[model samples]
Target: MTPSLPDILVGNFLCMAEPPPPESAGEFMAGKVGVVALLSLLAAQEAERGPSARVWENAAIRAVLTDAAEAYGDAFAEAGAGVDTDFTLGALDRANAALRRSLIALHEAVETAGDVVRDHAILRLYGQMADARRLDMPPLPGR
Candidate 1:
């Protein structure tokens, strides 16, 4: 059976952590290994969830723009009508970039119009987006 990427990463981390060399640089090497291990774990998490998060965020942004269309105009509607057909990380990232640009424009328009309700709604979505992308990173050593 093929080992999953996360499992493989963790396995490598374990292997690398053991049998520390009996050299003066052993501690330094351990520190470096710890950092790499932490990074590997984070990458594992991203590999599992990053794509879905982007897709969800894209849909969410589109929904917000669609709702704003009545107040904003056809441009808002057109931007919101975008759908994600490609699931590749690069494609998702590119689409996210485009949608976020539109979101920025929509937010600016709303702010300029003094639409407090819409502005607050966009702000809330921004918070949600940040929360969704958050990783469970471990604290660094020695605070």
Candidate 2:
């Protein structure tokens, strides 16, 4: 796969060595620049995907909610619906975590819906959720 230009750029910047000048380039060369550059790159990627990620993620959440709502229509479940797209970073993040947890529940519930087709669909959804949360959460559901 071709590396993203941003990644390539960050990689190049990170590979740069000290100027070998004043010799006073001491602490600054202690990986501080690399760390900051990587963080900046991460922030850039996050910003680029910020809106779309929330949109796609919320749709996933809503799909799960709707599926669960219909499956457990009377199961007294709590759906984390009505997410405001304009929420602050921290708040949106908290909602993201909550939605992820619910995704797990919805995935299992969907699988056990007593229908083969829906069961397969839920299995795929579970896979997608695993892909999305693989970095932060465990790969297995509920683990």
Candidate 3:
């Protein structure tokens, strides 16, 4: 049987000692879903409160997101065929890495930004990501 999401995450984390790579069509799809979900949330928040200075002024963040978006597009094109090739998996890995780096920057901004509401929102998103990571690998095994 296929492993549960958390189990897949944990197993990948333990075995690989890094973020889980998309090893199957389902995993690739799940990664895509996560990307879309975070991007959608960011878009909605920006639309409501306008873009944060940290987000707008950070060229690195912009470039990373743009690159990731393009990579995501490329991955999506191949996704229908089930990420069966090394090329497709490599593209997806690049996209995921870009997105993860961007998130780290945003989380750091959350710590320094003075805007209470925006900071809170960013923190919440960071928390969600952290929770996922926690599930990916426990802090102490058998605890």
Candidate 4:
């Protein structure tokens, strides 16, 4: 079976990691992986669909994606740094957290939208974001 886009993207991100404490590094890597996957997914969607008329019509969705894009960019920029310091890791974590929050808002807006095409497109993007987040989550202890 073919790997999904999020899986492929996360795999690529994890491949480049140099190894660190499992607890801290796992969370950090997961967050970075999710951000990279989400950004790539968003870009691909926009590229395939072009600028959506619906996105411009709905201020909430537009704002959500705009803010998310910015946060994702910030996180992506910091992703290459060595995770040797708590400061660096924390910065990336905050950025990814912001991005995730914005994405949730975007998904909510899209779900309530009346337009079928716009809803479908946004829903797909939202699903990808969710998948990325789930992929990056730390494993349960003793499970």
Q: Choose the strongest candidate by lDDT.
A: 1
List TM-score per model, in order: 0.77, 0.55, 0.28, 0.29
Q: Candidate 2: lDDT of 75?
A: 36
Flag clash pairs in model 4. Answer: none
Q: Listing every candidate in turn, what is its Cα RMSD in Å to the true structure after a full C-alpha superposition?
A: 6.5, 10.4, 17.7, 16.2
Residue-level lDDT of model 3, residues 1-143, one tens digit each, is 73333344455445445455557458675665555454444444434333222232232334433443342444322322221123333343444455556656544544565546645654565554444333222243235
Q: Name the runs in model 1 displaced over 4 angstroms.
A: 1-24, 139-143
Runs of candidate 4 with Cα error greater than 4 angstroms are 1-64, 67-87, 126-143
Tens-digit lDDT track of model 1 for 1-143: 73444566777768676776668366788786786778787777878888999999999999999999999998989999968999887788888988999999999999999999999999999999998877798887789
64 in model 4: Cα distance from truth in Å? 7.3
* Alpha-carbon deviation at 14 in model 1, angstroms: 18
The best-first sequence of candidates by TM-score reads 1, 2, 4, 3
Higher TM-score: candidate 3 or 4?
Answer: 4
Model 2 bad stretches (over 4 Å): 1-30, 74-80, 111-116, 119-123, 126-143
Worst 10 residues of 1 by lDDT: 1-10
Cα deviation at 112, candidate 2, in Å, is 5.0
Error of 1 at 67 (Å): 1.4
Output the lDDT of residue 5, model 1: 47
- 3 or 4, greater by lDDT: 4
Question: What tens-digit string does per-residue lDDT give for candidate 4 at 15-109?
Answer: 55646466757678777666666656654553343223222222333344654444344432233222222333334344444544555555555
- lDDT, candidates in the order shown: 0.86, 0.59, 0.42, 0.47
